[model samples]
Target: MVIFGGAGDLARRKLFPALYSLHRNQLIDQRFSVLGVGRSERSADEYREIVRDSINRYARVDVEDEEEWSSFVEKFDFVSLDVKTPAGYQRLREAVEERERRYTIPGNRLFYLAVAPELFGPVAARLKEGGLTESDGWKRLLIEKPFGRDYPSAEDLQAQIAGSFKEEEIYRIDHYLGKEMVQNIEVIRFANTLFENMWNNRYISNVQITASETVGVEDRASYYDRAGALRDMVQNHILQILMMVAMEPPSRLKPEAIHDEKVKVLRSLRRWRGDDVKRYMVRGQYTGGYLQEKEVPAYRDEENVPADSDNETFVAGKLYIDNFRWSGVPFYIRTGKRMEEKATEVVIQFKDVPKNLYFNKTNDLGPNLLVIKINPEEGLSLQINAKKPGTDNEVVPIVMDFCNNCQEESPEAYESLIHDALEGDRTFFTRWDEVSLAWKFVDPIRQAWDQEGADTLTFYEAGSNGPKEADALLIQDGFRWHSPYNPRTGSVVHGSPIGD
Candidate 1:
C-alpha cells in the first residue's frame, strides 16, 4: 500500500494506528508492504522512528511482542518526494518500483490521501502522470471528506479526478459509513422484521441524529469559518445517517443497490427555499465559557477566526422526507461545538397515542422512544409501555437494552474502510449520485442562509445545550430531542454539550 502524506498528522494519528492494528491481527502479511510517501526530507530509518512513537501512543497494544514490533518496523519505509514536482514523481515511482521488485508482490497499490483537501487533485494527477499506478494488481485511490464545498465545486472535483481514475476505481469515503454501528444501521432497519414494521410514518413521529462536540475549533478555524456547521456536518454526516434510517429496502446487498436507495431518499428531502428556510432551519454560535474543567475560548477567540465572523458554530434543522414511508415524519439533526457534554447518538421518537392511557397513569412520564446509540458509547434501547411499580392499571415507559460495544469488539472506521478498499468492496463507498443528490439538496438551504445572512446567529454559553432556537425548532412540532446521556431517565430539560 502506498500511503501519501505519511508524515502528516492524519497519517500519524489515524492511518498508521489503524494499519498497525491490521498488521497485529495478521490480516496483512509479508506479501504486503506500505510505502510512506510525503514531501519531507527523511530517510527510511528516520521515518520509522517517527512512526514508532506514533504507534506506541495511539495503537491499542496487547500481548507484548518485541518480535512483532521488529517485523512490523521492517515494512515501515519512506520516500521523500513532493507530488507537485515532476522530478519528485519520478523519485517516488523509482522507490515504489524497487519495493515491488524486492517483495515480488503484485503492485496492488492503494493510494490513500492523508494530506489536506487542496492537495487531493495534485497528488492524483501526479500519480497518473508519473505512471506510478500502472502495474499488475488493482490500483485504487481512497479520498477523504469535504468532497467539495458545494454542488458546482464537488462536480468539478469529480471531473478533475475522473480523468485519472474511473468512478469505480475511485473510492470516496465517509468515515461514518465505516463505523461499526453505522454499518449495522442497514441491518438494524432491514434484517429485523420488528424495526421494519414500525419504521414508517405511522409509528415514527420524529428522528433525531445529534453529533455534538465538547471542544472548540482550536485548529482548522479557517476551514470551519468558511464551511460552518451545516456544510461541515449536516451536508455529509447527518444526511448520510438520515439516509441510513429512511432509505427504502434494497433488493440485494450490492453497492449500487445500497447507494441507489440512499439517493432516492436525498431526492425526496423537503424542499426548503425562500422564507421557509429560516422557518425550518436554526443556526447559532458559541460564547466564551468553561468545558472539561478548563476555561476555553469562544469561536472569535480562536486563532484565524475573524472577530466579526457570522459563521455558525451550531445548526439544528428539521427534514421532512416527502415519501410514503416518511411523509409526516420529521428528521431532526443538530450539531455544534463547545456546548456541554461530549456524546453522539440517534433518538427515534414514536408518535403518541390518540388518548394517552399512560399519560394520566404515569403523570406525563415522556413518550416511548427507540434510541440507537452511535458513539462515545454504542447500543440500542427501546421503550415500551409497562405498568408502574406497585400500581393498578397504571402504565409507564421501560427500556429493553442491547449494547453492541460491551461484548463485541467494534473495528475502527478506518480499518473497515481500508480493508474494503483493498478487497475492492465498493458496498461501503459512496457513489457520485449520492454525493450529487446530497449537495443539491443542501444547496438550497445554504443559498437561502447566505442570501438572508445571519441576522440572528444566537450565541450559547459553553456547557449548555445549543441556543433556545434549537429547542424551539422541535418544541414547535410538539416533540423533543431525547438526551442520550440521561436516556435511563428521559430527555433533560437541562443543557448538554455537543460531540460524538
Candidate 2:
C-alpha cells in the first residue's frame, strides 16, 4: 500500500488507525506492507515512531499487545520523496520493489491517496509514468472525498486517474457506505418480505435523509468554506444512501448490478428550475450563535473563514422521481453544521389511512412511519397503529423497533470499508458510472447556485434548524422540519426517516 501523503492528518488519524484495526482482526498479515510516502525528510525509524504514537493515540486498542503493536509498526516504513518529480518516482519504485522481494509477495499494489485534492492528479501521473502500477497482481487506487470542487473539476480528476487505471481499479470511498447501518439499508429493503413490495409508490408517501452536525467547522474551515454540505456530503454519502433506498431490486447482488440500479434512481430525479429552486431547495449560512451553553462564533468569525464569505453551512432540498415507482413521492434532504442536535437519519412516511373514522382527532396516534437511524443511535423503528390504551375503537401510535447495533457493538464505518478494500470486495464502494451520473444530476443545481448568485442563499442563526426557506419548501407542500430539540423524547416523524 502506497499512501501518497502519509505525514498528513488523514493518514495519522484515519488511515493508520483503520489499518491497526485490520491488523488486530488478523485480516492482514506479513504478506502485506504499507509504504508511507511524503516529501518530508524523516528517517524510516523516525516515521515508525510517529506511526507508533499515532496508532496508540487513534486506534481503539482492545488487546493493547506490545508485541502485536511492534509487529504492525514493523510492517510500515516511510519513503520521503516528492510524488511529482521523476527522481521521486524512482525512489518510490525502488522501495516498493525491494519490499516485494523481501516479503516474496506478488506485485499487487493498493495506492492509497490521502493527500490534498490538487495533488491527486500529479501523484496519479507520476505513479503511472514510473510503472509502479504495472504488475501481474491487481493494482487499486483508493481516493479520499472532495472528489472535486464541482462537476467539471471532478470530470478532469477522473480523466487524470483513468489514464493510470481502468474504472474498475478505482475505489471511491464514501465512508458512510462502510457504516453497519448504511449497508443494512439493502438488507432491510430486500431481505425482508414486509418492506420489499411496500418500498415503493404504493405504500410509501415520502422519504427524508438528514445528516446534521452539532459542532462547527473548527479547523476544517479552509475546506468547509469551499465545499460546504452539498459536495462534501450530498454528492457522495447522501446520494449513495438514497440510491440504495430508492433503487429497484437488483437482479443480482454484484456491485455492478447495485451500481446500475443506483444510477437509474439518480437519473430519475425531477429537475428543478425557476420557482422550483426556491420552492424545492434552500441554502443557508449560519451567523454567530450559541452552542450548548457556550457562544460559538459564526463562519466569518472562524479562523480561516472570510468575514464576507458566501459559503453555505446548511442545505435543504426536495427531490422527486419521474418513474413509476416514485413519481409522486417526494424525497427531502437536509444537511448542515452547528445545528441544535447532531444526528444522521432517514425517515420513510407511509400514506395516511384511506378512511379517517375518528375525524382528525389529536392524540399520541400518528402516521405510521418507518425510521432508519443511520448514526448516533443506529437502528430501525416502525410506527404502527394499535388499539388506544383505554378507548375501545380509537387507535394510537406505537413503535416496533429493531436496533441492529444495540445488540452488538457497531463496527466503525471505516473499519468495515477498509476491510472490504483489503478483501477485494467493492460491493460498498462507488462505481465510476454511478459517480458520473450522480454528478450529472447535481451539476445543474451547483451551476445554478453559482451563476444565479446568493440572492436565494439565506442566512440562519447557528444552532437553528435551517433557513426558513427550507421550512417553506416543505410547509408549502404540507410538510415540516424534524427538529429534535430535546434528545430525551421522540418527535412527531412525518418526513421520511430511513428511506425518506
Candidate 3:
C-alpha cells in the first residue's frame, strides 16, 4: 500500500488504525507492506514509531503482544517526496520497489490518495509517468470524497485520472456504504418475503434519511466554508444511502449488477429547477447555543470562517425517484453540523390501514416503521400497534427492537473498505456513473443558492434540531420525521401521534 498523505490527519486517525486492525485479525499475510510517501522528512524507524502511536490511540484492539506489535510496524517504510514534482515520483518508486524486494512481496499496489482533492489527478499522473502504475500483479487507486465542486469539475477530474487508470481500477470511497446497516439494506429487501412484497409506493408512505452531528467545524473551516453541507454530505454520503434504500433488487448479487441497479436510482431522481429549488429545499446556518450542556460557538464565530458567510451548515430537502416502484413516494433527507445529537439513520414508514376498526377505542396507534440505525448504534427497530396488557381493547404503539452492536464491536468503515480493495471487491465502492449522476442531480440546488445569496439562508440554534422550515417541508405533505427510539430513556424524542 502507498499512502500519499502519510503524515496527514486522515492517515493518523483512520488508515493506520484500520491497517493495524487487519494485521491483528490475521486478515493480511506477512507479505503485506506499506510505503508511506509525504513531504515531511522521516526515516523508516521514525515512521514506525508514528504508526505505533496511532495504532495505540485509535486502533480497535490494544497492543497487548510486544512481538506482534514490532512485527507489524517493521513492515512500514517512509519516503520524503513533494508529490507534485516529477522528481519526487522517482523517490517514491525507489522506496516502493526496495520495500517489496526486502519483504519478498508481490507487485500488487493500492495507491491511497488521502491528500487534497486537487492533488488526486496529479498524483496519479505522476505515478504513471514514473512507471509506478505498471506491475507484475494488480494495481488500484483509492480516492476520498468531495470528488469535485460540481458536475464540470468532477468530469474534468475524471478525465485527468482516466489518462492513467481505467474505470474498473479506480475505487471511489463513500464510507457510508461500508456501514453494517447500509449493507444490510439489500439483504432486508431481497432476502425477506414481507419487506420485498411491500417495498414500493403502494404500501410505503415516505422514507426519511438523516445524518446529524453535534460538533461544529472544529478545524475544517476552510473546507467546510467552501463545500458546505450540500457538497460535503448530500452529494456523496446521503445520496449513496438513498440509493441503497430505494434501488431495485439486482438480478444477481454481483458488483456489476448492484452498480447497475444503483445507477438506475440516481437516473430516476427528480430534477429541481427555478421555483422548485426554493419550494423543495431549505438551507440554514447554526447560532451559538449549548450542546451536551456546554456552550459552543456558532458557525460564523468558528475559526477561519467569514462573519457573513452564507454557506449552509444545515440542509433539508425532498426528493423523488420517478420510477414505477416509487412514483409518488417522497424521500426526505436532512444533514447538518452543531445541531442535536450525532446519528445516521433511515426510516421506512408504512402506509396506515384503509379502515380503522379501533379508532373509537384509541386514536394513538402509530404508523408501522422500520428503522435502520447506522452510526453510534447499529440496530433495527419495528414499531407496531398492540393491545395494552390489562385493557379490554386499548391500543398503543409497541417496539420490537434488535441491537446488532450490543454484543461485540464491529469492524470500522475503513477496515471493511481497505480489505475489499486488497481483495479486489468493488461491491461497496461507487462507480464513475454513480458519482457523475449524483453531481448532476445536486448541481441545480448549489447554483440556485449561489444566485440567491444569503437572503434565503436561515438560522437555527446550535443544539436544536434545525430550522422550522425544515419541518414544514414535510408537514406540508401531511408527513413528519419519525425520531428514532432513545434507548437510554426508553422513549422516542419529539414523537408525534399517528394520523397527525
lDDT of 2 by residue, 38-94 (tens): 888988799888888777788765536788777778878989887768788887889
Worst 10 residues of 3 by lDDT: 491-500
Candidate 1 lDDT, 103-206, residue by residue in tens: 88787788888877777887888888999769887889999988989999999888888878888899988998888878888888888998899998888778
Span of ten consecutive residues with least summed lDDT in model 2: 491-500
Task: State how far residue 198 of model 1 sits from its true place (Å).
Answer: 1.3
lDDT of 1 at 412: 79
402-475 in candidate 3: lDDT tens per residue?
A: 77788888899999999999989999999999999999988999999899999879999999999999999888
* Model 3 misplacement above 4 A: 359-362, 492-494, 497-500
Q: Please report the candidate that would top TM-score against the real structure.
A: 3
Superposition error at 136 for model 1 (Å)? 1.6
Q: Give the Cα-based TM-score of candidate 3 against the true structure.
A: 0.98
- Put the candidates in lDDT order, highest first: 3, 1, 2
RMSD of 1: 3.4
Clash pairs, model 2 backbone: 207-500, 208-500, 346-497, 346-498, 347-496, 347-497, 347-498, 348-496, 348-497
Off by over 4 Å in 2: 358-364, 390-394, 483-500
